[model samples]
Every structure is written in C-alpha cells, then in structure tokens.
Target: MSKPLEQNFVELLEQHQNIVHKVCRLYTNNYDAHNDLFQEITIQLWKAFPKFRGDSKFSTWMYRVGLNTAITLYRKSKRTINTQQFDTVQFKISAEEYDSTEEDQLKLLYNAVHQLNDIEKALVFLYLEDKNYKEISETMGITEVNARVKMNRVKTKLRTILNP
Candidate 1:
C-alpha cells in the first residue's frame, strides 16, 4: 500500500474499528481468540481495501469483509468455554444502576448466540446492529428474501434456546 492509502486506511479503520470488534466478539470464545480473529480481520480488510470502490460507505464495506473473514477464514470448532465477564462501566452503565438479573439475562443471551452456527451468528450480528434485510442480504451474499427467512429462523431458534 502507498503512504497515502495506508494513512487513509488507518484513519478509516480507527473510526470504524468497533464493527470489527463486534464481529470478533460474536465469533470467538476467549480473549486470545478474539484478538487473533480481530488481527486476521484487520489483515483481510487491509488486503481487500485496495479493491474497495467508493460504491458503499467504508463501514458498510468493512462489515462485508469482516463478516466474510470471520465466516470463511476464522471459523473454528465450537468449544464450550465460559463467556468473559465484563465490567458494567465498560458498557457505560453505572455500577449502582446495574441489575444482576438483567446481567444474567444478558449473559444467557450471549451464550445462546455463541451456540449458533457461523452463518446464523452473522445473521444475528447484523440484525442486532440494526442492518435491514437488504443490507444483511448484501453483506452475506444471500437474496433479500432469504435473509429475511433466515433471520426469522434465527430468531425462532434463539427464542427456543432462551425459553426451553
């Protein structure tokens, strides 16, 4: 990469690194794995960045590449590892305002999400990020209708996991 392109990539990546982090969190089991996957995604993004025409927003393009990397290159055998505990302050919630019940529920939700297949997890991640069906379809290279159908099935699967 040229100096100017390198600088541009660094600036844009810094601005939208959270998308990579979110994808990393959804796909990996432990902190080490998360870091590894994040690194891999960043590397993949850097390699693919030169091909990125200004057809979509940088963040949107980042999502497509990030998801593809996670699904295709970074997937590993599922492991039943305990989820990492996070401080409430990290999430910007006051310690005093924290509810253990809600926290437990959140953990359960993540646990369920962690159990989903790679493709299902990608769907859930996009859905949680408020990406519409069209964007999800575009990101996953599925038809819009298939994205909607898969999302509904993912939702149903999550509900079953939570309620059963």
Candidate 2:
C-alpha cells in the first residue's frame, strides 16, 4: 500500500479501534488471547484494505471482515476442552432471593454469551450493539428475515443457558 493509503488506514483504524476490541472481548477470555486476536484481526484488515471500495461504510465493512476472521479462527483453533468434573447438585441462590446488581447480571450475561459458537456470538454481539436487522444481515451476508429469525433463536438459547 502507498504511504498515503497506509496513513489513511491507520487513522481510520485508530478512530474505530473499539469495534475490534469489542470483537476481541466477545471471542477471548484472557488478556493475552484478546491481544492476539485483536492483532490477527488488524492484520487481516490491513491485508484486505487495498481491495476496499467505498461501496459500504468502512465500519460496516470492518464488522463483516472482523466477524468472518473470528469465525474462521474459532473453527480452526483447538481450545482446551474443560476437564474438571462438577457436582450436579448445588446450592440455590435464586434471582429473586439474591440481590444481584446490574454488574452482576452483566457478568452472568457475558459468561453465557461466551459459551456460544463464533457465528452465534457474532449475532449476539451485533444484537447487543443495537444494530438493526438490516445492518446485521448486511454484516453477516444473510437475508434480513434470516437475521431476525436467527437472533430470535439466539435470544431463546441465551435465556435457556442463563436460566439453567
């Protein structure tokens, strides 16, 4: 890439870097993994930047590419499957009985979301970010109706996971 193009890319990335960070957070649990995934996403973006035309907003395009990269990596990587055994019978602290703060609920929600597959995580992330179905569909290259249906399914799955 030309210096001007490189500089422009840097500026745009710097401006919208939080998008990448959010993607990293959704995909990774630890700080090192988060940084590595962010770097990989940045590298992928840099490699594809030369082919970018202004057909869509840069941010929207970034989401598509970032999500695709994450989904691909997630499919290929061999993460350690949890090996510890857990007791089936546990103490009961019901939501109504326990005075949980908003942050506590947020943490629980994030933990549940972390258990989702990459594609489901992308959908949930986009939905949580308040993106409309049209935007989600465009970002994921799915039909708007499909996006809505998938999101509904994801919501139901989240409810089950969080509740169970």
Candidate 3:
C-alpha cells in the first residue's frame, strides 16, 4: 500500500505555502489582492504538481510556478493601486509595538519596491530570499550572467530610490 500522490502534493504544499505567501506579498499590496493572488498561485501549483519530477527541489519548482503565475496575472490585471499614508488595513500594528519612524521607513521601502517593474521586482524578491545567481537564473529562466547583471542594476536602482 502507498500514500496517494494527491496527499503527497497536499503535504508538500503545506510545508512550502509560505513561499506562496511571500510571492503574494511581493506582488500585491492590498490585503484583498494578496488573498486573491495567493489563491490563484496555489491553484496553479496544484494544477502543475502532477507533472513535477524530482529533478529539483519541490520548493524550487514552487518558486518558478509561483513567480510565473504572479508575473502573468500581474501583467494581465489592469488596476490602480492607491497609495495611502497610515494604511492600517495593509499595515496593522498593535499600540505597544507601534513605532512611527520604523513604520514610515518600512512603508517607504515597500513603495520603492512597488515602483520596480515585474521582472525587477521578481529579481529583488529572489535575492532577498538569499537565492544565488544560478538559482535565480533557473527560477527566472535567464542565464546566470543575466541574473547577476540585473541584480546589480536592481540594487543600484533601489539605492537611488531609497536615498532620493
């Protein structure tokens, strides 16, 4: 007797669902949009799981599918994102833990990240995840050299955005 493949998929997805959440967070600003994108990414992962061979890690495959789904939907969806100050809905904090300076800086950084194009944002997200150039190239379907070049450019862009 063997455990079913669907069960295995469920278990693996449960273990790695945080990756999907991170993707959703990077790609979507609003809570509603985050949940929506999360659901879509999970569905895409489940649909593609059957074809998954163990050549690479499950988490690696999830990154590719998650990023592709997010990038594709992000490009197709035409919607306006309203920027707001003190967006309690998006950044909830308890009264005790509230620090205006830290919160403001975090908000500023997020705004800077949101300014980047989809591919650049993806590159930044992968880099933050501590992925190497080779891993990023594999996840992004680009050569390692390309990933390194894009990452350096993105870093410079982020510095300019943050400082200026």
Candidate 4:
C-alpha cells in the first residue's frame, strides 16, 4: 500500500462506509464478529484495490467485494455459529417516533436475516438494498432464475419467522 493509494483507500472507505457497515450488520449479529468482519472486508478491499478497473461503478465493485469477504470469513471461521446462536438480543428501532415503527420492522427483518446462511443473507441483503434479480444474480454468481427463487424463499422465511 503506497502512501497515496493508502490515502485514497481511506477516502474511499469514508465515502462508502455505510455500504460496508450495512453489509456487516446484515451478515453477523455478534457485535465483535461484525466489527472483525468489517475490518477484514476493509483489508480485503484495500488489498484488492489496485486490481479494480474503471469497468464498473465503485459501489457495485465494493458490494461484490463486501459480500465475498463476508462469505469467505464465514467459511474460514467456525466459531461464529455458536457465538451467534448464543446472542439473540433483539435490536431496537432507534429512529424518530414518526418512522421508528418502520425502522423496528426493518430491524426485525434483519434479525431474521441474521439467522440465515451466508448465501441467503446475501440474497436478502441485496433484495433489501433494492437490487433487481439480474444484478443480484450477477453479484452472487448465481443464475437470474435462481436469484428470484432464492429471494422468494428469503421472503417466505422472513414471513415465517416474523409471523410465527
């Protein structure tokens, strides 16, 4: 990491911090593990920065990198499962009263998503992020039909969890 590249990466991180944080929170429920994953993703993104071409938008690239980093982290560490299962605290909706209920609903949705597998989490995250089936498929390396099917399955899973 050259000085200028390092500086530029810091700037990039600042600009896209929300995407990384959102992905991290969606992928893991444990605060410590979430922070670790966020750091790991940041490192991975920085390591892979030089290879990034001007082919696609930076955010799209970051999304791909973020998802891949998270999935890879899950694959590499087996401890997160037990830790995640033990800590099931429900996250409160912290927005203003006007939209707080909606925020709480979204929080519950993400909580359910947190219980899902990595691939499933990625699917639900993409869906919530408003990525169409085509883009989700491309980012996830799955077929468009499969993306739609998986997204439908995610919605069904959420409905079951929230309703039951």
List TM-scores for all candidates, in order.
0.87, 0.85, 0.85, 0.80
The sequence of per-residue lDDT tens digits that candidate 3 reaches over residues 1-164 is 13597899889988998899878878876778889999999889888888899878898899999999999997788654454343544433465585788778878877888888889989998898899998899999999999999999999999999998
Error of 2 at 109 (Å): 0.7
C-alpha lDDT score of every prediction, in listed order: 0.84, 0.82, 0.84, 0.79
Worst 10 residues of 1 by lDDT: 84-93
Q: Candidate 4: where is the Cα deviation over 4 Å?
A: 1-4, 80-94, 97-100
Q: RMSD of model 3, in Å?
A: 3.1
Best by TM-score: 1
For candidate 3, the clash count comes to 0
Order candidates by lDDT, high to low: 3, 1, 2, 4
Of models 2 and 4, which has the larger TM-score?
Answer: 2
Candidate 1 global TM-score: 0.87
Over 4 Å off in model 3, which ranges? 1-3, 80-105
Q: What is the lDDT of residue 54 in candidate 2?
A: 76
